[model samples]
Target: MNTILKQFLLVSSIYLFTPTVDAYSLNDSLTKGTAALSSATQVKGEAQQLVGQLQSQLGVSQAQAVGGTGAMLQLAKNQLGANTMSTLSGNATGLSSLLGGSSGLSKNLLSNISSMSGVQSAFSALGMDPAMIQQFLPIVLGFFGEQGVGSTLLGQLQSLWTPAK
Candidate 1:
């Protein structure tokens, strides 16, 4: 009994103190930039594809138009192109262009807008000075954090709310 207990403790301690498996650092330029971009791109492409599929299936972008996730996903895919991340990471010029203007909207927001013209019309009706809001949408999107939604639906809700006397 004493010998068996000793052997069990020895084996238990060895198992408990065994060296952990060495894990490779997942840090690298391609991973941080290109790989991230590729993933974002693939995600966006898949979203766009899904949106396309859903649109074809449903014959309406209304449900998504109301919330706009699929559209936004495709847009992010476009702005953060799989290849562009490699350049944008180090180049101020790429960074500046990303921060620049309306052209940037071609990605997420624009596609969202395009998904349903009625949505665009509704926003236009709310008296959005398109010329202004168009340029800074991304900054605003950034302010909202990862989901990049809530505010848009909030805006829609606000539009629906009746004015107080």
Candidate 2:
């Protein structure tokens, strides 16, 4: 009888302690997963915010681009003959055509907006509101043009929206 009692006692203690060990590991895994998810969510939110900043900037920039291109085209028209003006107008139309892919110009602009990490971070560091930086869009658009970024962004958006045909 004494031997039986000691064997039963040992079995019960082992089973109880084994569960505590497993419970700890389970809790640790859950904690790590939760932390990772939280970090991912934050990055996504920041990325969306950065996208918004870019969109606002793009609207202003596109307007400026169209306006400037129009003005230049007009000036050239005034200085040159109808034939020369036609050439300049055709070129501007071609440039703007790239912006007007199937998804429209806004999607292309949105893509450019997402890729603007350096510009966004600079704005952040300076404590400058992205919306408040309207005056600077033309300058930034010029930079984007120089870098061949605008067309690249348009291409990216086009690929995303292009039909599988």
Clashing pairs in 2: none
Q: Give me candidate 1's TM-score against the actual structure.
A: 0.18
Q: Give the per-residue lDDT digits (tens) of candidate 2, residues 65-158.
A: 3322222222233334345434433433333222222333222222222223422432332234433333344443343344344465434323
Best-matching candidate per lDDT? 2
Q: Model 2 segments beyond 4 Å from truth?
A: 1-60, 90-165
Among the numbered candidates, top TM-score falls to 2
Task: Quote each prediction's TM-score.
Answer: 0.18, 0.22
Clashing pairs in 1: 75-107, 75-108
Error of 2 at 164 (Å): 52
- Model 1's number of clashes is 2
